[model samples]
Target: MGAMSHPHHPGELAAPDPVRLLAVRDTPLSLDEVFAAVGDDAAGGTALFVGTVRDHDGGADVAGLGYSAHPSAEAELRRVAQKVVDDFPVRALAAVHRVGELAVGDLAVVVAVSCPHRAEAFAACRRLIDDLKSEVPIWKHQNFADGTEEWVGA
Candidate 1:
């Protein structure tokens, strides 16, 4: 038997090539690469958001955080990115999430979106990161200053 293709949603055009880059890497993320990916002549505005590990979370002093991801993390990230593209007038998009251990000031994730207007770019960029955090199969192991550790979003 042959595989069956899913039908498109109402008013859905073919999935546009809005994603310029999407990835999950063990090394540090590059802000330059993310910004470059969303460089488009048609776009009048570009917005970028970078999430970094901080010294505290929920009132606890965090020494550092170690990120771990399931094998499907990248695929889930793409799915989230696609949703952003489908919902926005995105000219281009890029997102990268870092894995492995990171210090308080290390960059954990970077997302960028470009659109014809600044408002659209800002909204799309926000959606990309919010959805990515809620939907992706990545967990954070936080080490506290008092020698305690906890895994978040596991």
Candidate 2:
């Protein structure tokens, strides 16, 4: 019971935060870097996710897209990562999101999580990406081949 309790609770120990990397960059994302950042000797499982720009979306032919992030985007991203570390037994975690113009098939984001088991790693990685997408102040401007444009999550 003592070990299971959180530090905020009376007589409990605080676990070290497991966020290893967090970034919102205008350059292309690197899967290797993200994966390496989450490497942990104690971790038996590692889960990784990469988001890529596709040529089509919602029946429209996407020509390209540009991502723009608010000044606080990186800080918000760290908050999301910290939440995942607190909720899961994350041994290590990393995430990087790309900004600026990206062509179809470009890597838009890369995230990885390592844990003592496969299930935990997968769950943490999923939650990290989901929360980042919804909570971060990153907007996407998509251009269609038909000369149409749309803003998403602005």
Candidate 3:
């Protein structure tokens, strides 16, 4: 589907659809929250994407990491998720991002998208995660044994 231009809103862009969006502390989030936001009577297919921190990255022997976000990160994340919903046939959607100190194998982000069709739901779910990683203001900090840290964009 072609990307439609969302009418601009004063002080921000238009947000036509956002079942849920949040930025929370680095901890295990409630799966119930995700399910609630992406649940709808009309949806027959639901897709979920959970992004986790791995023990290593690019062959780096990293110990752990942290994530920081600008104050407007949550709003931006909402916008992105909403856009996916608007562009596709998504019936409901939810995006949650974790910040602060994190350990290996922790959940970093979770994106759930539901739609009437399985293909659209799957496609929208992938797009939601890819765009979140590329466009969101969230950052990742990688720590090594040498006490060095590196901050990278999400």
Instruction: Choose the strongest candidate by TM-score.
Output: 2
lDDT of model number 1: 0.90
Please list the C-alpha lDDT of all candidates, in the order they appear. 0.90, 0.89, 0.77
TM-scores of the candidates are 0.88, 0.89, 0.81
**Top-scoring candidate (lDDT):** 1
lDDT by residue (1-154, candidate 2, tens digit) is 3668554442121136578889999887888899899887778889999999999999999999999999999999999998998888888899999999999999999999988888988998999999999999999999999999999998
Per-residue CA lDDT of model 3 for 1-154, tens digit only, reads 9966767322132124546545555567666788788887677788998887787777677788888988888888877876796688777788888888878888888889887778888998999999988888888889976677777874
Superior candidate under TM-score, 1 versus 2: 2
Number of clashes found in candidate 1:
0
Candidate 2 deviation (Cα RMSD): 5.0
Model 3 residue 58 CA deviation in Å: 1.0
State the displacement of the C-alpha of residue 37, model 2, in Å, after optimal TM-score superposition.
0.5
Query: Which lDDT value does model 1 have at 111?
Result: 97
Tell me the spans in candidate 2 whose CA falls farther than 4 Å from its real position: 1-15
Task: Please provide, for model 1 over 35-75, each residue's C-alpha lDDT reduced to its tens digit, 9 standing for 90 to 100.
Answer: 99999877888999999999999899999999999999999
Worst 10 residues of 1 by lDDT: 8-17
Output the better candidate (1/2) by lDDT.
1
Q: Judged by lDDT relative to the true structure, which candidate is superior, 1 or 3?
A: 1
